[model samples]
Target: MSSSGIWQPANDFRRVVFWRHGRTLWNAEQRFQGQADIELDDVGRAQADKAAALLAAVGPARLVSSDLRRAKATAQALADLTGLDISTDPRLRETYAGSWQGLTFEQIADDYPTDLLRWERDDISVRAGGGETRIEVAERMRDGVLEALSGVESGETLIVATHGGAARVAIARLMGLPYEYWGTLSGLSNCNWSVLQETGNARNPGAEGSWKLTEHNAGTLPEPQTEPVED
Candidate 1:
């Protein structure tokens, strides 16, 4: 114990389930929503309903969401099912696409080809439409996840409802990866979630504890394997 009588490196391990928002019209069109505040389409709402039913079965203790409309709507489904209040954080928002916000992939490729190329090359400093770089997105997202971790107790699950880009950056940052390696983790599909469990070690103590990826992009219930008898 420290002289201050506080637990070093925090008091407990935690579980974070990072949920990607359901589909939007732009998502179907392959347009980048970024921070555009697009709401969910009808199909998206249905996806959220089914996904929430499954997630609520696990009974997450806390719920935090990106302030964007699409994310909020998806989170709301879970909140409704679980009867848990929703907390919104702007830092959980997607990487801003800046000038590419409303443009299709082909449009951006034809017009802002240089920027798109840099982004595709994993240029951490490259901005899309003067929007945030991968590093900037990582830093802010790390802040939100860390803060969320600090607020929740050990063993309690924190359901973070955020965008695909933001969730990847946050998870990569928590996993202690350099910004360049963020691309190794695939973007989550709509209404899917990734799980990170805090597995702290008493042997080594730090303000931020270690996390493990127990699951990634899980959307459906698990299937039980049936054994063949009397072949």
Candidate 2:
């Protein structure tokens, strides 16, 4: 925690594992979860168990997750494996779907045709159900992620369990990708993960704390991780 009672990110804590939560009934049905609190189905639980086993091998120093049941349950798998407690943050929750919360993709398309078309174009300004825009989601998610990183020890790895849309925003933000290019990054599948490593000297404020994307949407256990590109 920092002077403002928020996590102040530091350069020394560099490694990050972005884990997407396991599947849910809505997910299988193509329903938008948004900020809805939904639990994992049986297969989803099994997926978490398998993913946690793989992530544990990475020796994570901390575990952070969204408070949503799906994400919480997914993070619980890693917590059980690493014996590290879980820290939940509402900021890390999924994109607020607003009126689209429980609606299936087909329904959203049939009803909100204009909005659906805008979403397909990856327009950051388009708000589903008059909910959060991509920019808003990215900024809040970035804050939540940096805060979690600030709480970990130097050179330690942290696993962040969250939702698909939310995870992509965080990844794009960390990669320093421009807002317009946010559409270039796709969402992660259930139980898949990505890794981001910090590069450069801890003392160099600007040079330090830069991130590289080492892995993305990995379904199997990851091999020895490599450093992300130093930007």
lDDT of 2 by residue, 1-231 (tens): 333222324546467888988878887777877898989999889989988887777678889999999999999988887789999999988888789888887788799999877865658888867898877887898888888877777778888998888888778877777777866766677888877777664333123236777777776534322211100
Once superposed on the true structure, which residue ranges of model 1 sit more than 4 Å away at CA? Answer: 1-12, 201-209, 221-231
The whole-model C-alpha lDDT of candidate 1 against the native structure comes to 0.76
C-alpha RMSD between model 1 and the true structure:
9.9
Q: What is the TM-score of each candidate against the true structure?
A: 0.85, 0.85
**Per-residue lDDT of 1-231 in model 1, one digit per residue for the tens?**
334221223335577889988888888787877899889999889889988987886657899998999999999999998899998999999988887887877788899889888886668889878989888887898788777766676657789999887787778877777667767777677888888777655122123336767777777623221210000
In model 1, what lDDT does residue 174 have? 78
